[model samples]
Target chain A: MIKIKSIRNKILVWVFLLFLAIWGGISYATFYQSSHEVEELFDSELAQAAGVLSQFASVVDLSHPMIDPKLQKDIYGHRYEKKIAFQILGNNTLNLHSANAPTTIMSNTAGFSDQIINNNLWRVFRLNVKEQNQVIITAERYDVRNELIHEITKNSLYPLTLMIPILLFIIWVGIDRGLSPIRKLAKQIRQRSPEKLEPISVNFEIPNEITPLFSALNSLFGKLKAAFERERRFTSDASHELQTPLASIKTQAQVAIRSDNKDTQRHALEKVVEGIDRATHMVQQLLSLARLEPLTSLDETSDLNLYSLTQTVISELDAESHKKNIELSLDGEESIQIKGNQPAIEILISNLLSNAIRYSPEQGHVDVAIKKVSDRVQLSVSDSGPGIPEQDIKRVFERFYRGQNCQHILGSGLGLSITQRIAELHNATINLSHNPDNGLVVTVEFVAKN
Target chain B: MRILLVEDDPILGDGIKSGLLQDHYNVDWLTDGGQASQALQTDSYDLLLLDLNLPVKSGIDILKQIRKTGNALPVLILTARDATEDRIKGLDMGADDYLTKPFDLDELLARIRALLRRSKGRTTPTLTHGELELNPVEHTLSMSNKPVDLSPVEFQLLQLLLENRGRVFPKKQMEDNIYGWNKEVDSNAIEVHIHHLRKKLGNDLIRTIRGVGYVIDKQ
Candidate 1:
């Protein structure tokens, strides 16, 4: 249950444990087998010893080895015979015995029995010979058989216990060798500079288990390179666009400084102010567009009425439309709900409305419509102005793209691009279609919240 | 000097035109490349101030056309594009010089003067004839060691005839150069300026070619 954090340690611990378990099983089997063989061999030896003694008693013909069963009590009275290692007893009497055996009979009747004689346990066996009317009592030390079994089992187990530490060291070294590729990869990554976005080549001698890891990391590096490239291009293009108006401002300010007449100086100063305003607006638009790039989704949103939002944006641009005498009118549904962030959606609506107003000619008409088509809420703004040409429409959403026809119009050329981005933030679809009646109709569709 | 200014930006073009007028040079400003190209072809100008970015046509194409036709009209590229490659392209495409936008008015005037001087195959900034010295940058005329005070038109008339010493200019052409297309001029305006120049300097400096035009002899 120890939570090993390192792969090397985990492998080492697991292999060591498996080795110990297998060794323990094999040692147990060996000991069991050895013990079984020893038991059979010892029992047979005891029976053979008794057989030898029985033949010896048949031939000796000494004082009738055991003549009376009543004489065993008299034999127990002889304490001096306790030191004998063998004994012969018959008919409940012991007539002859070795010094290690008890003077009394071990058993009155037995084939094989375990007895304590002179404070030592023995394996005793008896054979009764009816032809001689005698019993051959043979006993061997029981501890001797156990001691032999113990010796064989010890030989089998001693080597396994002594080898545990050395085997652990071998396993540890093996795991370290196996994980060297990972260590090499870590060192390579650590030595790399932060700006090194180039993809790492996977043509190293890495293991098969982590080759996928290298491929995934390389793909990430590729993505990072592309992102950095995109960011560089964006900064370059943004600076280029910003410099144009700044150049205008600088030129006009210098002109004002050198102008001898009040009228020309006033006019130059006024233009300088206009250029400042235009630059400021362009900067705000640029920041807004830049901010929208990293937002994958909106965090705070509500079910907004698309009709009401359009009305609000129209009212905000009332003065601008009035300057051009554009007849701005709203149509279709009074209320249609869409899920979106409020400020983002407001910017979207405002950009569209202002773009329409900016492009519309004096006394021209602009139509703002809100419609709920199935599950989608659609907002369309149409203007009676010079619509985009067939070729320019595709690039209309590119930053700082002012159409050839739109060059005469006063614009920073970031309006539609911002509008498109805001619409994208809301997961809405924006479309631009050329009107046959010499105008443009822009439609934005959002999924209905209801 | 009469300068043809081609710029798409309204305020910048107006400021440039106004600034040029204050320097006593006749200036005609057009807002786009197409109009400027047509003017370059049909009209005469001392120099062309061209903007690179325009609606109908780019100034590069106009420059290519002028160079293709072997016209040595001095063209100065005035643009908002400050990149090294853009400037190189503008110059290599037969532009006399290049100037990025938001430029100093003084530097613009100095470059224009230099370009005009170089176009006339002159290295120095001043036009000289015998004992008369005309400084275009300072807008001054001197007889021997004394500076002469002359009106703007008289100064222009003297400068035009002096720059092209042997060539004779008709009354209409002189009038056109004295006053750009933006202005209305009296029919005898050039004669009045010539008479004023004669009175201020000497009658022998500018000659009347007996109903042909005015000319300054090569001294």
Candidate 2:
């Protein structure tokens, strides 16, 4: 749960803890083994001292035993040697003894024993001598033996204890050297501005473990640059398209204001209204198309009968077709169903039918057919209108692309593009073709909902 | 003066045509670039008002075609594109003037007058020959400090001859200046207009060259 923000600090803490744990383990192991070896050697020396005294007692005369009370001290002196003691007994009475031996009998027991003599605990070894009543005992102080064990343990741990800080310093430096590339990368990113979207290319060497990080960052920059370019072009195109209408409105208003003749002035004023209408329609269309840009899918959808939907759209534009004197008819299956958002689909249908009526000659016929083609619903609108040129058909879906035949036609030129987007959202396909009358036949195929 | 106005938008083109007619500049309006290009190749005009974004062809391409053929008509680009690069491209390709869209109509008319005056080798907005003065912007004519009342055709014909000063124009050339694509002009329309113009001003102002054409002699 501890949050270490710095990468350097995280690595340093974990590595330092590992060093401490390993140092403690090795120091404890050295201390344990040395103490065990010292204890075994000292115990065997106690038994051997008892054995040597018994041999000397058997070889020499018992009644004239050499009582070397200061004999060992006279030969050599050591702090630990002063704690060693021995005695020989005949009939439970003291006979021969070392310089450090007790004046009284140390032990009457037949084997090794720990005893308190004169308030000092000693490790005593007893053995039988040459005669029936002869015995020898060897003893060393218990506290002195423990002191020797601790001394050996302390010496073994001294070197390992000195190594811990040196290892800590080395680990800290190694982590810093390994993560230097990260600091360089952060500095490079901090220096960047939005206008500069070029991919990052570092000069220094990068390790293989972090190579994917740099490559991922560069790839993201590439994607961001492409998206920004697309948005910029869309804005430029929208402004250019909008400017044409605004220019028309301004020019017509100017003409109306400047004309002296009543008829010309009235006609100019009417055209000013028309220009305003056209500009308003253009902006609305641009907005609706822009609103669809970020939509991955429709938020709400319902299963609707295509026949009824097309009929409803046709009625909505009844006045438009009536003014143009175009005969609009609907046919095919009556209750075929498809799933789509109602408003979006309504715009698509309205655009298509209006376009048909607008382009058809006076009293020309426009037919709409909806039916189930295999598992899909097919909706087609055919008109005896001027069709797009064969070469221009490819560009018909482009925004603001008015074809050669449609040059004089009053249009915002974004209808087909909007329809295309709506079709994309519904997972449908729209096809443009020519009928036998050399007019346009637009067909949209949608997945039929059972 | 006659001017060819090429614009793709229906409302704007109509408005410009009406405004140009009000100013007494015989105007032929076209809604497509290809038609404008064909018209430019086959006809003559005093000035061209061109829109860059068109259906069949672009204004830049039409300008290039006209310049390649050595047609020296004054071209003014009227476009919705306001980018510096677009303006530079239009001017560097032999366009005499460039105006961005949403512009004032008065400014457009002024620029047209300046370009026409420059093309006629005149430093001022008014054309003068001796005691007669013609103001293109006002579409007015004055002689000897008195205003002269002349018909629009008579005024155009007199202004054309006066702007050229020493040049002689045949009868066929005068019909193009006085009428546009749809107007039906009579055979002796230019002569009758000149007769009216001479009667209003003076006899020596416009003189006939006999077998050649009509010429308004320089001072």
Candidate 3:
């Protein structure tokens, strides 16, 4: 199932093929030059042999009946040596000939010529010795010169043929040694467990080419470790928050069961119901916060009217505001549009509005506005309540961080956290500030779609 | 026994206070750290039930401050943090006990009882002076195996004096121990409670040191 093209295999194949091509070219050139030099050397030897024969004719008595020269075997010559024959000619007569020499002249008046003698092609070199008034013709078979060139060519190619396999082996080993770091890195990764998100150690030496890869992998591990730690902390805090409410409910129910008087029992039952309601609200908020945390993509978004969304949230929270006798109103641009997920945006606005209403004092006023400012749509909710303290303003977006001034309020402290998460999902920015008049003002700015 | 319950969660604090009241323990509950710190400095309590998380000041800081003042008040930490490190930190900071939230009502009561017993330098849950035995859990008193009925105030007064048999308790201290901060006590409240205890348990069982206070001689 592994479909990777290995770097080691690629390197081995390419380098071997290149080495073969270069070696083949050098061998061919060596064979060709040796063949050419051998041919020229044998040709020159033929010419010099003709001149020596002419001098031998002068020393011998040519006027006496021309005696046929006996064939002689040279003890120092190789077994495949070609026969060299020469004839001395005076007044158009064959004066001397070896045992294998042709009776007919090989070539007439030639410096060097090719001819057939005794059904074999010969390389004939003729010299006219004017001092002795004789012509010397020295001839060697063409097959003999060709055999010499072939032997030289074969000898020159022998070393290259032996060196090719050794060169291939060396190339393979060199490539493997060069690419060992990558293999080691792959093995190191394969040996790790899924839960082991610790950074890979850089203790051993590595090549410069693969150092960046290691650094990137280590950084990725660091990020994954941090993400897991955050998740763990969130789960622990959530369970802790849930346990408190459940403890309250259990204690209240116990109180109800232990009471002998009806009034005390009824009061205890009321508290149990209240505890359940608070726990349910906290659970719902926790679920909303969990859902909002992973909404990183905006694929399910559409053009939403901020003004209408603000009005809908305000209307939904009207009863809550009325219970506290707080005045709630929505105003500003009528139809400012931004692209966002409707439910996410609704949650974002509802959290802000509910938080404002929950913290606002009796008879306090809450104002909501949606306005188009430049290229953005700004949705702001201002409440007349005690705002967060200066030190706590930065941590309001953290889950379950209730402000010092508003701890008595019935809240799970996840409202602003959820709001911040949803805003980030829709590529929006949220800001919390103290209202100059009183209370806190929360503003969410979304980039305009159009 | 008088107990100071410092918790930030209103409903849980109320539930614990009501539960403790049903057992006839004088409980003064404070919802924030600032007031709880102030109360601990100005008032006296047999034991302290401290919650680690609070609004203005954290419970740990109050515990630290209490310890810093060299007050060896028995502190039971009631927290939603069940981590081992948090427990260790609380105990290392001079807390006498640690309890995580969603705790059993019986367990909380037993821990409070144990803390009170430990603070009074007693190993048993029942207080005894000679033949009179006061069982706090069962809310019963017996002299030589015969049951005796006493009102809640008389029972608390007898339990306090019997727990510290050799030591004398000033009248004001006894009154504060029997009543919470919000309860308004008449000037003769302690005297009436002491008279009722003497009537139920016998005159020699309760002693009045005139200018000092009341004390039961160790048997």
Candidate 4:
């Protein structure tokens, strides 16, 4: 699996890029609007200046004679005023001009136009003075107008340039503060020991964004604690149950050694063997219970015939039931095939059958049947034994819980638990009920495969 | 001394019974809690050795019932549960002592002897009456400081009578103490053992009251 990038870094990078894009767009719009407004303002000023010059020219006397144009200068004129020059054109001749004016008509047009005078580009606005029968042209260089536009844009953008670093710093701090709860939670989890399964408490108030995360983690801790508690109880109970048989074996061995009579010694020795067998059975059952405890998936798959499987388990237990004079029989649909884990299904069948045979009275009957009911394959095992009490039926599936009625019987009490676990693995259901006459009927139903 | 041993496991119960018998104490072994409870209600025993996990009824329930009836029987709980909480519960429920399973037989015998001694209102394991002295632990009988040999049954009979001096024991009770449930006894088995004990310990040591039973005088 690829390592995921940190949420904090991702948020920071994306937000910063989005802010930079928005700021750039706004700055471009502001520059575009102000530059257009400045160009229009400068054009109006040139028109007004041309109109005033035409009025001044119409007022001046030109009937005497045409003379060479003299240098016109204003003592109070600004430095850029030198770049603005005008001329009066009468009948395609230069009549009057400023100091920077060329000795030629700038434009023949009667409105604003561009002209190259003395190899320099100029913006000339011409006006018609009808009383004088002449046109007055006001011209300014292209470089001067460009220079003024640049100044306006620079002054307008100065604040935004300075605000960029400050905005980024504020965002970085805000993200850090917002993510502090998650960091604290991580630190608390990292410092915890495996044995300590307590729920973590964030010392600071959790932000809304990560509250669900914290709650989920706490719930997981709760489940883990419960699982650990269950494991501990199982280990303790298993040891205690094993200790009894071990004690019996030890005490019986002592009895054998202390006995002087041959018959007594032999009896003690036989008891020792019985004790060993009981302990071995308990250990085997404990191992089976442990194996089924973990929720591991069953890997083995095959088509299992319930009727045949029941028959095989019954045959294996034939001698045991025979010793007690109990009759075992199987009656059901032949070749009832179901898809399942073969060994797990076999174990499930074996436990139910053996339990029935073990709990039945002498000469009692144990009947097993399998059938297809609706969308399910149903298997039922009923035995003519003293049924469990009403209160103990629910507790029978718990590990090491023996019914009060069946205390005389030898059992590790793990059979039903294992059976239930296998049923769960197969997505099946098992139900137990007291027989109407005097026994228990266990029904296991598996979903039928098409 | 007679002990009522209520244990569910057959092998362990049988082994304990055999060991107690070897020590010259009468033991009536029972494997069912209900049956043991019935015995406790109907009969008299010196000490009760009860196992916690039993059939039909649990050992703790039986002990509680016994105590509720004002039966101050010294009970020693024998079980495989060694948890501290279990031990405390057993003791708090009026058990005189608690012994975990897989226990040493020697330790069990020692605890039994102590309980028996405490019940009889005595501290020593040795019983003495006039010139006769008996060491219950060593299973020895001596008269006037000289060792005497006695059969196992005769020794057990003499020990019972000596332990409960001045208390009359009928023939049936005496026979029950001397023989186990499986043992077959002749009609005159108790009389024959009494005869052998009188001959060895002297006739005056045991006084047989007419139509009652035998008792050893405290004097």
Candidate 5:
């Protein structure tokens, strides 16, 4: 059900999907890497600023009862650029310094401590301040680093958001333009009537991938043209061949009507009747051949009992063979089942049998046999009569081709042609040869399904 | 026997007219489709021989018009188109028989006779008068149920006679029903076959109208 008509559309769809996956992956990786990097830089800068301010703690003059405005200015100045703050803890009493530090200081007896204050995340480092036995806790606000990362990420994502609609638009337009030639070809095919079998002449400058499609279509059209020509030629030739005998019959009948004498009139009319019979026979054969031309494939999978079909064909021709004193026998194994189109196989066998019966001399024997090999079923018809010449054997399968020596025989020469076509349709082959004593032998072999 | 011949070609029309005249069938022929349609509307011909392909109107159209008016006239289609679809179409359009073109004159005459015999409702009911009896359903004829042995052809002949027992049936109609539509019968085959039937059924059953044809006159 998946027609391989449009290769470009498939390639474009895959390409667009791959682009989407890769773009998403790269954006996520860069965003995660930059955010982690900003967090690490913020941590290291806070620790270094706390170290620089600890050296200035020796000048604080802690024995003073009240806080010094000079010390506050000194600490605030040192930590101004890095947005750092600190708390000085002495005997469970706390003194906080810096612009944004809360009035209540954190209890930090350990080396370093980090916590959130007033709904703001803070990273605080605890210093011992060994001279006073007081804990020096230093902290920095976290929103500054986060704000920088957010700005950088927002700038990077703006172009990607804008590209989604543009990418989809390009894919749609590319697929439509790529398949335009296919639509043109479909329209060209639809414009043709059944009687017209001309090849498609519309050509476009396209990619290398499209050449195979064009060539495939060209070859199919070529075959269709040839088949139409063959059928038209066959019909006209058959009409010409049949017209002669019909014209003769009409002329003879008119002549009989004009004649006054009874004997002459009766003789002319009798000749006319014979001509009419021959014409009718020829016309029937021609029509059957025409019908066979359009049937290219076989209904080989049907539940066709070949034995019954063979019996029917034999019975149809039984009366003719009885008058000729030729015995038509069906020799085959019971339940010789093979899968093939029944009607074609019947026509194949009938033509061979009729040829055998027609060419055989009076009282000569015709043997029809069927056998099943390991993987194939073989049906053979051998006649005891004058055989086909060695040179003309190949030519007999061609349309309207008859052997030179068999010119005296009553045949239109389409029988073997139709039989060969049927054999080709079934993927079977006809093996023809001359019988050793005097006659011809033709065999059709069918491939077994199992 | 009178037949309405509906054909297109002038030469074939003239030839068939003369040919039917020789066989003692009074032929009123029309060469155009319009004329043929008009003739069927007014005339009481024993049979209608129609060609499938014609100018101004097709044979199928004409046949459809005939059947639409509930006219039970027997129409035989004679055409060059022998495809299965065309035959099915003609028969579906209420044609009694289909004969392809370039056919034998004898065969054509025989088919026309067959259609005429069938048109008279010869096969629809059992015909009985006095000691003579014929059963259309069983296709058997008997004199007082004595089991008269007859060939298939002779049985059909007796049935044709018994169906039209009260009328003078023509010789051509008898040959058509008995010999089929394709067999080439000479002019005398009908006469000879009727003679044979008379011999078997007793000579008093059939009467020969001189210079015309044999007839099964009604008792």
Candidate 6:
């Protein structure tokens, strides 16, 4: 349940990895290039200092009775900054000209090339004066190369350091601007009431990422609106259904009183009673359908003894069965236990049994059975009467759909539909099959609890 | 009493016209609200039993037209819409009483009588039928207008029978009306009550129809 509000967190995660990769590549490249450039600059500067000092050394006479002061001034003043130092080693005496005026920048050692000074760590280039039987070695402090490297690093790193905050600010603004539409959509939805089913109007310029979500929400609203409209229509139709019969009864009763003949009055009163019965039936069915609308399933969590529920429904139907002489019997598993809504299960069983009895011929037989098979609990009701036709099997589960032949029977045609709906709610399947023994068999099966 | 019934269904309208005729109430039945409304504009009626739904114009509209000119005649709404909302709507539209559809015939007649009695203010202290008369206010009985002594239950039973003369009041409705909602009466309580009432008022005053309830004819 981590709440992620900023899309930039995701963007930053990806961008930061890329940024690190590019920074690493650039840092390595610049480090390589600057170090190479420092080496080249040091080599050239060493060569130039050697060439200038050689020219000055060739003009010097160590055995001269008088060394010209001007020549000494010229040699000493040849050095602008004491980055380069000169030393001449010959015959157990060393002549050294240092940047510190008699102090060498590095201890010199040479044998036909250049060497590093161990004590002072300077760059030293050696030139052998073989004819003079002497070696002239020039040295410079390492500060000249170190200073150049430091300057290059400072120039390269300054802009990179300043860019970190600017990059963060850009990411922040980009994320906020990117998520603005989602925020607007949330506000619009929050302001709406549950009854409002209007589609959400969002910008076409919205990122492809959010378009599918908006369309899905719009379609969901459409379905919600349709369901509400259907419910409202059902209520209105129910009222209309109940109102017609009541009007008939009242009008008939009032009419019956005006007739002077006793026989005519008796007939009128009988008709009025019939109208009342019709009205009562419609009201009961309407209420039952209303209750069934929102119910998804019968409570199927509780352990239910199917035997008890069947026995209760059968007992209730006993009076009718006796009156109709439609021999009703319950058989099969004696103590069948299952998980289901007891009342819903009872209602489904009752409707089946009642319909079987009502539509069955006088003295017909209704066989009800509850049996447990592997991984399934099955309840079957078979009647020795005219079974449903093959084509009408699916239609039987629709509301208010009485078979063409069964119109003579007094029923709202909701009994079987409610049964099917209840079955669907419980994740049970209802199969209507024509019995080979000349009747209908309705089988309801629920998956056996493991 | 004369009654005007406005309804749309021909089968029901004919049935009601005949039922009222048998009850000795002169009923002029109109199947259309427009005809009924026109008829009422010209004539007068003691009571109007109206159905909410009708052809041409609704019963409510007819009632509105009738009431517009200051007519306060008693109106009883007899319709099948039993929802509390519909009942309230019918009553608020100037109906004196409301009865849902599929109501017992005896119950309808009783409501009509109650409405008419209230509207006319016909307060006869002793309500009479045949030779039996019961004084509701004084709780007394009179045979031929002469005072007669009777037990309290017998007196109440005689009063109910006389009040609904010539109509067979079913035992169930009588048991419910006579006894309170919570009172526990025997299964044959109405028969027992009728037995005692008949003994005091004389058996002929309370007639029993087989398979039906009791009735006191207005001979």
lDDT (Cα, tens digit) per residue for candidate 2, span A287-404: 8899887899999999887888899999998998898788999998988989999989999999999899989989998999998988999999999998888899999998877788
Task: Show model 2 residue runs off by greater than 4 Å.
Answer: A5-7, A44-169, A180-194, A202-219, B66-73, B216-219
Sort order, DockQ high to low: 2, 3, 4, 1, 6, 5
Candidate with better lDDT, 1 vs 6: 1
For the record, the alpha-carbon RMSD of candidate 1 to the native fold, in angstroms, is 7.3
Q: Which should have the higher DockQ, number 1 or number 4?
A: 4
Query: TM-score for every candidate vs. truth?
Result: 0.75, 0.87, 0.88, 0.77, 0.48, 0.53
Go through the candidates in order and give each one's C-alpha lDDT: 0.82, 0.86, 0.84, 0.84, 0.71, 0.72
lDDT per residue (tens digit) for residues B127-213 in model 4: 888888898788898999999999988998998898889899898888776775547889889889899998887889888987878
Regarding DockQ, does 2 or 5 come out ahead?
2
Q: Which candidate has the highest DockQ of all?
A: 2
Please write out the lDDT profile of model 3 over residues B76-107, one tens digit for every residue.
99889778888898999999998888888888
Worst 10 residues of 6 chain A by lDDT: A99-108
Provide DockQ values for all models, in the order shown. 0.41, 0.69, 0.65, 0.51, 0.02, 0.19
Q: How good is model 6 by TM-score?
A: 0.53
Between candidates 3 and 5, name the one with more favorable TM-score. Answer: 3
- List residue ranges in candidate 5 displaced over 4 A: A1-24, A48-99, A107-112, A132-137, A160-218, A241-268, A283-393, A399-410, A418-450, B1-219
lDDT of 2 at B50: 94
Docking class of 5: incorrect
Model 1 over residues A284-322: C-alpha lDDT tens digits? 898888788788888899889888888888898999999
The CA lDDT at B159 in model 4 is 86
Task: State each candidate's clash count.
Answer: 12, 1, 0, 0, 0, 22
Candidate 4 per-residue lDDT, tens place, A344-433, comes to: 888899999889988988999999989999889999999998888888998999988888777557788888989999999899999998
Displacement of residue B105 (Cα, Å) in model 6 is: 15
